[model samples]
Target: MTDPSDAVEADRALKDKHRTMWALGDYPALASRLIPELGTVLVRACGVKGGQRVLDIAAGSGNASIPAAQAGAHVVASDLTPELMETGRRLAGEAGVDLEWREADAEALPFGDGVFDIVMSCLGVMFAPHHQAAADELVRVCRPGGTIGLINWTPQGFVGQMFATMKPFMPPPPPGVQPPPLWGTEAHVRELLGDRVTDVEARTRMLRVDRFARPEEFREFFKACYGPTVAVYQHIADRPEQVADLDAELAALADRNLRDGGMDWEYLLLTARRAGQAATGPE
Candidate 1:
């Protein structure tokens, strides 16, 4: 049997490779074009009023940070990947906004206590291995009464359904697989944050994502976005052409949404707030 650590490393490496490829294009404009007013929506959800010190964790390609900066907030954007940050910096610069971009992890933040008025992350904390530690870090750095805003995927809906369908195409893990649980669910997130934070409001926003423009676009996006899953097929499939068929099948499954300009993907947007009142109450 293959060692589990090797599998993890391989998967991580594959994801990193795909992320690099995805970052090669015009990131800011791509994001802007793909998700119109996404930044504005996220910034507003984060309660990022002007002049507030905001920390955007896992600031991938300025999905959250640029909007905050544009909203007149002093934003500190941090990410685990430097390449993503570089894209973020270039995008922010092009927008004529000065943002402090730092390379950091969600579990280990490099900030003083009670320094920020808002600590926000969009679709970031859910991927953390030690989600509790990440949640603590978000709270630790926020001033008392400061808000902690987050956007995570909810377990149900379209994205969840896609994962279920794609499971068969994924490689099998060795015994004792112990993959991380889906962290976007409301119950799971609340448990991860524990009882400390308050005014915790978790709601899902239905986001329509254009997964691809057409069948050809689907092929390109999958090759670009899906990493090891395709690599696995290349190795195990009896026939390589099976991969093409699989792509066609998936495109067909998304036919209603893909018939037009792009495939419609539903994304969950979750939001929560840090409590200023007694911690014992509901969050």
Candidate 2:
């Protein structure tokens, strides 16, 4: 029989690796300059307003949190990586706005049940190893009738294709871990949230991501600034052939996808309301 303590330790170790992976690249800079203003989109979609209590889970560098705060909402930005939160703290301070930065895991958010009027994640939370746990937490902390918003890269988007290209060069993920892009599909998300939510709405939006002039530029930028890509390259550092293969594949993905002016990264923007408050209370 497996010891409960052993299982706990294993979970901790996995999270440790995840934290380390994200902490590797300069994500704050990447989010600020390279990535689109996804949080703004989510905040607008969720209709975040002043006086509302908001929680931005897996909020990297306060992308969504800062905007929510700017909208006059009381926002708390939480993520497992303290480093990213610190970057967000700095940015918020510079903007003369204050956001409660908390280091918390997506699967087990450190917040009370139905505590937030709005819960959001922009290109975040989907990376959580356990989809069900992450989805449950998003619903659990949101008050009845409150909104839960998310922006995730679709499985058929450029980012998803990039991940697929790198898959051959990467190690297998932990058991029970689902691909992050699954969160971007309407059907998958519906299944995950189940009947706990209502007024389900899903929209496919395109973010212009023409940061790189060439395919090689995309590969180089991600290798240097993106955490997941950086981690993959680092994982196979000793394997020169695999590294070369990944480099070639990544470049090809960007090259083919690049369009008239730039690449249109497709993402699913989903918003839903938590089913009315539990009859009694949270179990």
Candidate 3:
């Protein structure tokens, strides 16, 4: 068995690496273009209403946060990357929405228990090094009877397949670390939330990426703006053969999902309500 201390250290290292990967490239430019519709969907699913306290954990570029705020919720957008948070600030301003942007980690949110009426994450939180810790934090800060909404990329989806394709070029994850896509499955979500929540529901949605003209162009766009893709490109920069292989694989994957001049990216939308207060005088 791995030493407990070593495991902790490994997790810390992994989180640092994740932060670096996300911090690289201009994620907001891509997020602003691709995530607004999904953000609207998640806000609706969470039942966010005027005057409600909403927290968007790992909110990339304020996509969900701006919508929730626009709908009249008192929104707080949190992320680990300062650059991303700044991007969100600018986006919120541009949209004429007000939001409280905070630099926070998903595994360790800096909020009081039962504070928020709704907790939501968009293609975020699942990237945390400790899945259960992140899940617990989401529930802990949410008031009883409040909703938790999430959008995650499914393992069998195009993005997941792309990540798998790049796995050969990247280092293996630490032992016992779960892939972020696990949050996309109903069974895993159930396990993560356990008995802490009720009315758990999950549905798959197809999000389209249509900015590029061709599969090769799509791959190149990601390489320029998506951090993970940029990291992969940088890693294999010296290996021409490996670079060619990566490009070929990504182009093929993108082509398989292409339709109407865009690619269909499938993701899971999850919603659940925290168990409410028990009746003091039961029947």
Candidate 4:
């Protein structure tokens, strides 16, 4: 077994790699094509109202943050990637929505306790190296009786399966690092937020992607824009056999999930209220 200190160091290094991976590519180019509407759905579901303090943690390019701010909420968007945050700022400005953008780690948020009325993330915080730490921070930053909204790719969903397909080519995750897809499961969500929140609810949604004539085209699109996929493609670039194997697997997975010549990316949406006295405010 790896020594405890060694494991800590390994995880820290991995976190750095994650930050670099996100910063490497233009994620907004991909994020904008998919899941923009989901942000609006999440904000509406969380019941964000004018003047309520809202936080979008692990917010990538201000997808949810822009909509929340447009709804008149006092929105602050936080993410680990400065590049993504900059993109978010530009988008917010274009939308005529004023927002405070902060470069923050999901595991250790730079915010006070109960500082926000609604804390939200869309397919973002689940990528943190420490799942429990990220979950705790989400709960910590939200006031009691305030809402927490999340959109995660379920383990059995298209995106999760895509990650699984790439597993053979990618290096194993560090010990003690939980699979991000666990956040998509109701049982795991209940366990993660144990006794800290009430009225926890979940629902599934299908996010459709336009179909590609060839799987190689699909692979190229992700490798060009999606950080994790790009990392794996680069990691296996020297090995032709592994590359062929990955391409085959990805093609098969994509074909299986195809709906009317398009791809159906299914995900889970979870919303819960932190346990405490409800605050009377605009929301």
Candidate 5:
């Protein structure tokens, strides 16, 4: 069995790997179709009022933060990886938006109580080692009547189905191992948020995943963007060459169903508003 500490570091390392690749400015180009639209939707859902202080948790490359700033909100973008936060800062500058960037952990925020009118995370909270604790922190720093919005994928959704299909080819951990809790289900999100938020809303959208026209492109994209899964694939396929074969098979599957120049993948958006009463400390 792998050491628990090693597993934790591996998770962070995998995220950092993606962060470095994302900093190279490839993801924005590849994810151009879905990312911008998703970012816009999340920002609008936050209902950014002019001059409102907003905390963007896990503001990877400033996808949602830039839009919030564009909407005239004062934004503080935070992420566990400094590389991502720096990349976000640079992107915001290029877009002519001013955003304060901070390096912080999602499970334990560095802000005071009632510091932000809105706290939002786009596909962020789900990766927390302690998701419920992170959720509590978001509520702790949000002012009374403030909103805590989260955007995450729903389990058993289209993307989840894709993962399930690919799982058989992936590697395995020791045994009886559990993956980190990502906000992939509505029920999980609800349970994490608990009674802190008075209003909860969720919306599902089909995100078009294009940019992979060839099998080789899919191989690079999947291995780069989905590193841990690739690690699993390397382990289970019994050899390195077999991993390439698996990618080819998946690419062929994707190619068979291409419509309107892109493959459609479903994603979910969830939003919740904190109560008007005084904020509750972390649970």
Candidate 6:
């Protein structure tokens, strides 16, 4: 029989590994420069107001958290990687905004039931290995009738295709770890959140990413700046031929996707209200 303590220890070890992986690349820069609009959009859509308590889970460098705070809401920016959260804290300070920053895991958030008015994540939380556990937590900490906002890359989107392309060269995921892009699908999220939420509204939006000057630039930049892309390359670093092959593949992908001086990545923006106050844990 499996010991409960062993399961707890295993999850902790996995989280530690994830923390290291996220801190490996220049994610804060990407979040700030390219997708900063996403955070603002989500905050506005959720109607974040002054005096509301907000939680930004998996908030890498406080994307959603900072904007919500700027809107006068009390925001807590929580993430697994302290290094990433530290960058957000510094940015918030410079922007003359204050946010409570905490190191946290999405599957097991360190907050009580129904403690927040709005819980949001921007291109975050979807990365949690255990999707159901994370989804339950999102519903758990939110007050009944409060909001939950999310932005995730769709499976048919450029970013999703990039991950699919990279999968062949990457290491196998641990058991029970779901693909992050699944969160972007409407039905998938609806199923995950289940009946614990109401007023479910989700829509796909196109985010034209014009960050790269040239098609090849996309591949090179991701290899250096994106944690997942960087990790994949690092894993195959010893295999020069494999690295060369992956380089060509990624460049080709960028070339195919790039147009009108940019690439269009699709994302889903979802909002729902928490339901029963007692439906915090999964059955």
Query: Which 10 residues in a row give candidate 2 its minimum summed lDDT?
Result: 274-283
Q: List the residue pairs that clash in candidate 6.
A: none
Question: Highest lDDT among the candidates is held by which one?
Answer: 6
lDDT of each: 0.66, 0.90, 0.87, 0.88, 0.71, 0.91
Model 3 steric clash pairs? none
Per-candidate total of colliding backbone pairs? 1, 0, 0, 0, 2, 0
Per-residue CA lDDT of model 5 for 152-178, tens digit only, reads: 766655456556656677545333233
Q: 1-283, model 6: which lDDT tens digit per residue?
A: 9899998898889888889899988999888768889999999988899988899999999888988999999899999999898899899999999989998999999999999989999999999999999999999999998999999999999999999999999999878889999999999999999999999999999998998878788988888889999999999999999999999999999999889889889999999998865334311
Writing each residue's lDDT as its tens digit, candidate 3 over 1-283 gives 8699987787677777888899888788788776568889999988888988999999978878999999999999998888888888888898898889998889989999988889999888888867899999999998888889999999998888887899899767776678878888878888999999999889998998887668898788788889989998888899999999999999998888888888788899999988987323201
Could you give me the TM-score of model 5 versus the true structure?
A: 0.78
Instruction: In candidate 4, list every pair of residues with a backbone clash.
Output: none
Full candidate order by lDDT, most accurate first: 6, 2, 4, 3, 5, 1
lDDT of prediction 4? 0.88
Q: Assess every candidate by TM-score.
A: 0.74, 0.96, 0.93, 0.95, 0.78, 0.96
| Model 4 weakest lDDT span, ten residues long | 211-220
Candidate 5 steric clashes = 2
Candidate 2: tens digits of C-alpha lDDT, residues 1-283: 9899988898999999999999998999889876648889899999999988999999989989998999999999999999998899999999889889899999999899999889999998999999999999999999998899999999899888888888888788878889999999999999999999999999998899867788888888889989999999998999899888888888888889988858999899999999985334321
Alpha carbon deviation, residue 119, candidate 5 (Å): 0.9
TM-score leader:
2
Q: Which portions of model 2 show Cα errors greater than 4 Å?
A: 277-283
- Name the lDDT value of residue 212 in candidate 1: 66
Cα RMSD, model 5: 4.8
Q: What is the Å distance of residue 197 in model 4 from its true position?
A: 0.4
